[model samples]
Target: MDSSSVCHAEHVPSCHAEQKRSIHTGWRADVWTASSLFLAKISLRPRIEVALSTLACMRVPVAFLLVLALPICKSFYCYISETLSTACMPVVVFVAPLCNAAALASLEALAKQPDISLGVISHFPQEQLPLHIRLRLAAHWQTASALNTAELLYAAEKMHTYFGKIDVLLSTNEHVQEALALIREKFGIAGMRPDVAHNFRDKARMKQRFFEHQIPCARFQRLTSRQAAYDFVEQVGFPIILKPLCGAGSVSTFFVDSYAQLEPALAQLNPSEWNVALAEEFISGAEHSLETVMHHGRAVWQSVSRYLPNALDVMQNAWIQWRIIVPNAAEQVAYSDIRHAGQAALSCLGLETGISHLEWFRRPDARFAISEVGARPPGAQILTLHSRAFDCNLYEEWIRLMVYDQFSVPTQRYACGVAFLRAQGYGVIKHITGLDEVMRECSALITDVQPPKLHATPTGTYEGDGFIIVRHEETAKVEQALEYIINTVRVTLG
Candidate 1:
């Protein structure tokens, strides 16, 4: 691969074409870079005169001149709107566990955006990423631990060395949001602050905000000691949920149903001040996820997805195949209640600008309760569903929203759902059955399928080995297709 070019991951053999294009683009960038340095050191009159002269002499394109004026243009726009650029490419540092599928997808989206210099900070080496992704990055820094504050700060400094002025810091991983927020603060970057990020990252703090704002959420307490755990159990009674204060997904989460389960749960939790746990009342209701896009401290756009059964249930039952549905008319009047409540929750939690994934419940009595929310894009192909439903690229939308504060909201065009295929009696996948039948019946509806490889070990997560996505215009039809898939497909394990 050439040093200057980035081939799309899907198209690697044409690397030379990409490199040639990059080489041509470099002349404009060279002008931008050198002129920017001189403009910074000189006064306003000379800066403008020299910049204009240089551009005219080089016969720079009109677009290149506009790129030079991006800062002034953004200032005018922001001031008028009670707003927000540069010839120098804006530097954005994305932090995550690089090897994860979601991170790779998010990175690809960022790379596709024009004019911005992208840098990556992660726990894994740059080689962990696809060659195409590595070639696109202006720079990559590996930290001993992505979560460590000092290491992150050092990495940011190194990225700054390569690409001047770290303008925006972002991460889609829920596990590293707060750490990234802390780094953002240290660098004086304009984004979510640590205090606000804490409200979303720490469940205990999050629930406190909910209580203060009078938002209906599960009854929860921060277990500080053995006695506190016992007291919480006494208050909430049997069938409680125990989870890490800042856990992502269902990892390290426990569902205790009786007295006999309490001791084992407590033993596993090992609750203490340094390692506190959260115990909440087990909510018995239909679970759903709300994806909200917040701008200027308000909810601007939103979507919803329903879990066939909650994540915890799937985590407990390895044999269960998980499914998620994105209704065609998700924003209909039926979801009006959640829309109002979810927006309110985002406001109180201090989501200034970005996408948030909130988990909530609709009780048997037809009331809603906020379970938790992450100040980042959701996982498990939820965004993929939105892309199919709306006929737009949500990954690119999310990138633009975070990096440029712009969103071209897409209209919903279809309903979509995903069925996770988990093999029964897992050790390694030995056989897959019923796929042919599914294709014969639901060929037109199916959009994508990732089949498990023979002899592959189970992933041991709720998402299971592989998944199939189906899309349609009617919500009921999508649901029926998902049900049919779950009943038909079976992956036999050795």
Candidate 2:
């Protein structure tokens, strides 16, 4: 039969129609009842709305059928192939950082089923994907830097297969704004606007909004020229920090301690490339991060992490080490304060549902000041640490929030922390000593260690040499063991 004829045949009001049209008067009533039940079963769910919408805009019936078949096929395969819940869960497309080994592993672990798809938009090539995998099986991957009209169209086409509609579209890089806009327009996906993404990506704009909102933050001046930077330094005085407005991973971030050092630092910054830089008043004291999950513009799940040596100090001194301590709800007063500020900041920025990573500095006097906020998860395996420590998978929690509007609340069975190893100097790896002794000493708390690779470069700004993640119900014991590990372990380089 032709495609239209098949469509009409399947969509018939009842099997009685076929019986009346044909000479088969002896057809059983049970057959008609079963057919009606099957149609009703498929039509009642929300996914059908998605499937029908996907089909409405397409002209090719075959392509539409293939597209509609993905989710159904996935559900069937998962039901038979794996030991997971058959209940329908909303699918989410997670766009994550490229070459992030820790994040990828954590995400894969959290997605109990294949409901969460990964998309990387960076230097990675699409052809590198495994041949056995369907392109739709792969998270609609693309490069943010090279995204164009064609790529967006291609993504829309590819996404049309598995998903009739996308519940959420999460992205990081500012360059992918056009692509995200295309996805929203084509697929009716709901998410942050391209402008909101841009604002979050651009440090200057984000800081300005925080300032207008009367939020507490370090004083910052945006500079475009050497003279402009000089004037700002003159006004802000010495001991300020300089960083690229659009940079990540703490690259090109420098601290100016004296007036004489300003010119050399300014010369290192490219006016055409680094176009703008921020000269901010340095806040001293311990540093911490707040991981928040917002839904419909409200902060629902929040966790605070206290950084051991502070991020700036860890970046400045190569040998200095740091650890992240995730405290239980009852013990985290400082974190509670940070969460309050973070919610306010999200509201001011008009951020709705999604994950937000916010960094802040806690003063000795107990006041907290906002540093920065990213629209994605915290970097350097924070998600892993949170997951293992709490026994709750944060990546999966993020997916659930995005797709199903549900948040995973940790039972707070234990506190977790990770100590990042820092090299004594810049060089190739000679040897890593004392790991066995360190592990023995912190055996109760130490859970895992990432050994340094051979010929590894010394850890510096934005580079994570490696780290040891530890967990325990007793926060004091966890902290003590972490401190001992940091002190006893030695990383010698050639």
lDDT of each: 0.81, 0.65
Best by the TM-score measure: 1
TM-score, structure 2 vs. true: 0.73
**Pairs of residues at least 3 apart in sequence or in different chains that clash in candidate 1:** 71-85, 78-83, 78-84
Q: Give one digit per residue, the lDDT tens place, for model 1 in 22-67.
A: 2112222344445557767878887679888988999999897888
lDDT of 2 by residue, 2-107 (tens): 1111112112222333321211111112233355468677756687777677777775587768887899889757644432331133445544335355435534
Lowest lDDT sum, 10 consecutive residues, model 2, at 20-29
Error of 1 at 9 (Å): 14
lDDT of 1: 0.81
